[model samples]
Target chain A: MVTEGREQERISVLGIPSLGDRFAVFETMVKEHNISLVTPPVTKHTLSLGARYSPEFACLPFKGILGTFIECLEQGADTLFMVTSFNACRMGYYAKVQEQILRDLGYRFKFLRFHSSEKGLIGVLRAIKRFSNNASWPTVVSLFRLAVAKLRALDELEREVQKIRPVELEKGTADRLYREAIGAIDRATSFASLRQAMRGYFERLEQIPKDAEYAPLKVGIVGELYVVMEPFFNMNLEIELGKMGVEARRTRSTFFSEYTKWGTFLNALNDEKKELQKFAHPYLKRDVGGHGLESVGEKVRRAGDYDGIIHLAPFTCMPEVIAQNIMPFTKEGIPVLTIACDEQLGRAGMLTRVEAFVDLLERRRIGNILR
Target chain B: MRVGIPRALLYYQYYPMWRTFFEGLGAEVFVSSPTTKLMLASGCSRLIAETCLPVKVFCGHVLSLANGCDCVFIPSIHSVEQKVYSCPKFIGLPDMMRATVPECPPILDPDVDVNTGKRDFYQAIYKLGRPFTRSPLKVRKAAETAWQVHQTFQRRMLSGLTPPEAIEGMFPQSVEEPEGNGSHPIFTIGLIGHPYLLYDEYVSHRLVPQLREMGVKVLSPEMVERARLRASICELVERPYWACEDEVIGAGAYYLGRGEVDGVVSVVAFGCGPDSLMIEVLQRYAKRLGKPFMQLTLDEHTAETGLMTRLEAFLDMVRRGKRPQGISPPASWSQRGGSKRGSASWVYLA
Candidate 1:
């Protein structure tokens, strides 16, 4: 508070590579600390840059994040935030390797890392303190709450978009509204304004002219989180399916929802997750690391709801590879189409496969109707 | 009861303990035949194209055990160390086998995660023994003996014996020393990789035997003690999170830093997840130290002749020693510097 003349340091959290809008939350959080936030969207340049510097056979998400880091550094981001997991996947050591690569590239920056499993809320507070320019705890905590509220609202908007996209009368209508909703949500400066923005968008989304006679084919998407959530990595698969007049429902929740579910005692009381584990128990009895358990569980659990299941994964993703191998034997009698996404995946090839799968699903439905 | 074990993956590291335990429990143990071309082909046919070679080999071994025994033993090893996991493929091996490998016998999968306290660890052992005999006392005795044998195997490895030699010494009649024991080797090469890749002659293309024939002494990660490995791996900026990294990063760091071996060779399966990162870390470390390092990537298509050519070239470079210090010309070049060499240099420049 005493030094008003200190230069402003720009802060940037590790970008999700696809969901650039989520960085707005971090921007708001850093605002109280007098640090500017650098939020950059993933581009082709980012993918190529990350792939060049990353170790071959490292998963797709790692390359994307590494590319984003280089981009952030170039954009005058002096402080970078990243979270590492404790165990299970290769994700835990991502920060370590990325830090090494960044240092070797001769980038001058400060890295603030947190173990996703360790220290819990206190760890987050301490990490914020490192780059927060000595902002008071109460202000930081309030701003953090506001950011979490915005994140939850943003996730809700994403889910709402998915529901309306398939049945909309005009294509791209829902996507355009989503972009507009995001801008309005980002402009909110308080929790009440955030709530107002969310509610208004929810009403506007429901009012969009949707096809009343269209009964869309439902497909459950399950795989590694980064590929499932990141549109660029999966080639905007959800939107593509929606454009084809098929509804894409993601079996896995976003990161914040996952935290709320497992990070708290609600994990024990969540019957939906319990049912998933129960159904998956026969096939995958233990966690195979990453989303392998969830992938299997969601397939079995949603066999009745989803007309088909698309197992999207990165090539050589250890857990998902195991899941894909075991999926056929789940014996849920549901048709499964596994698409392993890698840097080499082509949009034309992916669309052809997806089109064939949808055709099969439609034929199966007709066969059932005749019977 | 006849229990079969696939001679793959952790089998090279823990076969002694498993064999001793099965015998003590009054069950005849049948280990699958060593890795062969036919076995690997059958395994690859069942799995997707992207699985690492080691897992594919493991599947092949499991398929071989289908008709021989009443039940097959496949352990779901979550983690050997606290908070450090085995590769996902290993943790989910039993599930994969059940789904893909047709006509496989009933599997007895005992979970082993040392992080789950002593009681849970013993419970897993008891689960393994219950199918053999009803008495808990027999199971306890078998577990105790198995632990001792595993410890002995580890100690022998640390005392300058390779895994194959140490395993052979466990059989009382074959306490013979390794061949060419007294002869001093011209070059000692540090071979770093997983036990399965290092000891599986088919996968490794008989690397150890070939090295021995070439008057080279081979040292593997198993020959290093656990405490020494722990100390050596601290050189890394971040301690590796994989349970089996001691075989790759730890051994590579030790050999490169201490100059204990003249050259370091890391053998990695082509699509292996853990080895991908571990190899990068070691390769960069070796480069920083200006050490002679070679990476031999193994896959289904790895040809023996190609591997041999690379091995010979790397060894030849090691024998030549470090590059001549400065840009000094050779004696012949200096003598002809006035005419022939100057013309050749001009042509090269052009």
Candidate 2:
């Protein structure tokens, strides 16, 4: 408060494109906390940069985050925010190693990490206060509430998009509207306007003409959070499935569910995760980290609902590797296709695998109908 | 009932306790034979390509025990100490075995978490013992006796004996120690890694015997007291969460800093998360101490001849009083520098 001519530091958080306009809400929150916010869009070049400097065997999310951090640093962001988990997964080591690598590479930026488990809320608050130059708690808390509401709204919009994408008569209509909805949500400053913006997007999505006669094939997607949520990392799998006339349904989204879990103390009462554990008990007795157990649970729970399942994980991900190995023996009739993605994976190869899987599913469905 | 124990992973370290506990419950203990080529092949066939070698070998051992045992004992040990975990594979080993290995016997997995107080510990053991005996009191007595045996076994290992020697010493009638002990060796090398990687002769290509034949003494992490090893790693920037890896780091740092051993070799399974980070930390510390450090990452494709050659070269360097300095050369250095004359650089297969 005493300083007159001091410049405030710019803060940046890595954003997944599939989260749509949810990141814009985060940006608004940061700005409200009296800090400059920089949102660097994840691109192919970002992935390459992250992979280039990261350890060869590091998981995909680590490489993606590293790439984003490097890009943010280049864009004049003086502070970077990251989240770490305390689970058995490799995520706990990612922040520490990435910071070491970043420092070794001679980057001059403040690195702030928030623990995803026990100290989730406190860690975030402390980080925000420090990064935003001692912003008042009341301001931060209010902005945080707004951010959470926006995330929930964004998740609802995305869920609707997933439902309508497969049955829509005109392809890409749902995706385009989602992008526009994100922009409107981002620009809406007040609670009333935010609600209006969300309603507008939902109405627009409903307007997209549906194929009444077509019964789209439903495929459940489950895996590590980064690969499952981010389109580019998984080769735009959801959109591609929609283009193939298959509906891609995922249980977890990056923002609403995960954000709420981490941003509040409600994680301890997570009944859904408890139910997943019970379902996965027969296959995976323990949480091997990442979404390994959850992936198995999702498949087992929705085996009858979805025609097939697509299990995606980064190369060398231990937990998912365990899940992938166990998935073959689930006794559920649904066929599962496991794809391990890394930077080296080519788009053509991914498409071929996906296309082949869809063809197999289609053939199986036709054969079942004939029988 | 015959309880099958796979002689892999934590078996080298905790076999005595497991054996004693099962026997106390009136069950016959049948340990899988030493890792063999066939077992490794069987493991590789059952597991995914991305899994580490030790896990694959473990699956092989499970396959070997399929026909003979009534139930396979695969403990899902979550934490041995407060905030210290075993590898994730250990936690999920039982489930993985049940999924991959067909015709496998019923698995006996009692969740072990030392962090959750002694009551829970006894409860886990009591559950394990329920199938054998109806009385919970008998299970408690057996668990106590097993604990005592394990403690004695640990003490025996700390007194400069290998895991195999300690196991033999614990159960005198069960195993025989080879004759002709050499009074002293020309050079001593600190061999550090998880017990399974270090003690599994097939995985390590009989590393201890190979060193012995070469007039070298091999010192493993087991030789050091657990408390001493714990103290050694206190200065580390981040204490490793994996209990076994933490011990390896502790013992490795202690030896490297004390300059007691001429060289250090870390035998790790390929794609192990804990080992990779721990080795990196050890490498940095070793470099600071100007000691020769080599990390041998074993996988399914590991060839005996190539491993022997590297071991010989490393031992030869130690014999010549040549201390390695700075960063170690990459694995490709051997191929590239082989054509050049008078270049003695060897590859560190990490």
Candidate 3:
């Protein structure tokens, strides 16, 4: 098929796990590029598309991606824009492998990387213009605005995390408000109203009692930082635990970077000083993987405080993987639950697992005042 | 004076070093053996049910070493950089293991002396060496020599050289790739997994050959350069917070998007942390690109039949250009997709 004057080119894009309001960015990019956005149908078929190609041990995200591509094929998508990085972990080379596999299967698509983005605004503008071909300049501007709005809103929400974490209000209540606010923002029109809505939401969020007496169990959520912060990405997990009457105390939050960084090393010296100031305890040594702070947290919890501990993380996080290798011998012998959440957890299943975790905590421990 | 070492966590990497280090000081080092099914099961039963697999494995090793060693060595490991963390269980392990296995033996968890900012590791070693010989200087000398030996060994491992070679004074032969018959659909498949799992024949159930049967070539991270991997990542998004896991994810995306390799397989130990995030990210990327990807979460109890069945299905689907037998994925996919070609004449070198 010979294309005419402006070369009416078709381009396709894929969506990975929601990194918060990135869709607005894509929608804008599509219009600016004069590209028709073809979202692969997300169904059991798409998952099988991945299962057919992916190794069985891979988590749900791989399957979800494979599924999307098959859907795109059925929808007549031509090019697949793959964006990612190589550092941090293993997902960097994912696009290349998937592309090869898709090619082998006779699905033809042009693969483009965002590598050219680093060349500055000119390079970015040139690439966008290359894709946008027939699109008007105003169209590109509008798209950028949408992307900007989405990013701004997400950045604002994450900054207010202190309102939801431990030493603040009840864990679940703030999340409840946050989710409600986000959902409302989706339908909101005026930017002023969205701010007011978020404010109103946070205000109500403060109303949720952080100090709930006689809660059945208090648990600590510790693990890799990325999965900890993203609620939808991790399955609305904290809120689910709360509904079961479990007072969740997530220790790892965005706010504690300074403390976690400096304090982690200082903890060893501090523990020694605490020991020296008290009785000459012979065996009061630091524990496995150099986490004396957690040992102290365990002691505090064991002292009629939190009933259980929960370690949450992504599967590949090596450090946490090492840390998880050890924690069985706390003073309290506290029952600990380790939960790993990935993109595969679609609300219902995650809530069920969380519910079960809470139930397990309840059956094992007695009600505590601090919880 | 037996210094007990729990055969868990860094025991995979540090076992030989710590054992040799302690022994060099003339203190008998008693390292625990691998935790077996019985020990792991017992630990699982004892600990909370919600614990990650590694934590369960650690509990097993701790229980296994409880009565066997004089003092179980629990190190207080901290991140060397910002935003990095050792597994959460590690933080509370010394205390937790101490409480759980109280009678196993006395644990050695020496915190740093604030005044000197030194851990009891050297001091404790010096004290333990007293029984071997009462010379304080001699003990210090032995400790220093032992530390030097350990540092050399560690440096070798970091250099991608086998740790065992540092001691034996001989490096292993080059990693040989099996000669392949030239054929269509050449795939340089990237395999993401823990070194233990990738190297362990028993655990992975000989996954490489299984893929090779379908003409898929495997590339482990150990085989690639950091530069090559970094070059493939999409620089459009913000650089990820995690350097290591992000590299694998980004590299996999890079190669997969290159239209060179057929597919990428992420084999993970069940409950391993980095894979948790990486697998999700890979799948998300694949979804966007409308590509095929899979992750295998393996545990000690990974069944060969289960693995084989899944492998066969995935291979079949990749070759057949459709979902394989007994496999029906999500009926549709995300409308948001990855790279695609506008024209049929587009030269995609796959």
Top-scoring candidate (lDDT): 1
What TM-score would each prediction reach against the true structure? Answer: 0.92, 0.90, 0.47
Instruction: Name the lDDT value of residue A319 in candidate 1.
Output: 92
How many steric clashes does model 2 contain? 0
In model 1, pairs of residues that clash are: none
lDDT of 1 by residue, A270-317 (tens): 555567779898898877878888889999988888899888888889
Selected candidate, larger TM-score, 1 vs 2: 1
Q: Ten-residue segment with the worst summed lDDT in candidate 1 chain B?
A: B341-350
Candidate 1, superposed: residue stretches over 4 Å from native: A1-20, A128-131, A261-273, B172-184, B322-350
Model 3, span A203-318: residue lDDT tens: 67556666544434567665544455445446655555555555555543222222223344213245443543232122233322222234344434443556666666454343
Angstrom error at residue A33, model 2: 3.6
TM-score of chain A considered alone, across all candidate predictions? 0.90, 0.91, 0.54
Model 1 RMSD to the real structure? 5.1
RMSD of 3: 12.8
lDDT per residue as tens, model 2, A1-371? 62543343434433222232346656655565556666666689989999888765677888888898888778777777776665677777677777777777788887766766545576566655665566678866766667667877878888899888889989999999988887777777778999998888888898999998898899999998888877778888999899899999987634454546553443522666778898888888887777788889989998888899999988878788889889888877689999999898888899899999999999989998999
Error of 3 at A243 (Å): 7.9
What tens digits encode model 1's per-residue C-alpha lDDT throughout B1-350?
A: 88898989999899999989999999998988889999999999999988889999999999899997998989999988788888888889998998897689899899999989878988999988998899999999998999999999999999988887788888755465466643678788899999899888899898888888787888889988887787778777557588888999998888877756878888989888888777777877765665678899999999989988888887776665433445444555335324221212211100
- List ranges where model 2 is wrong by over 4 Å: A1-24, A119-127, A253-255, A258-269, B174-184, B288-290, B316-350
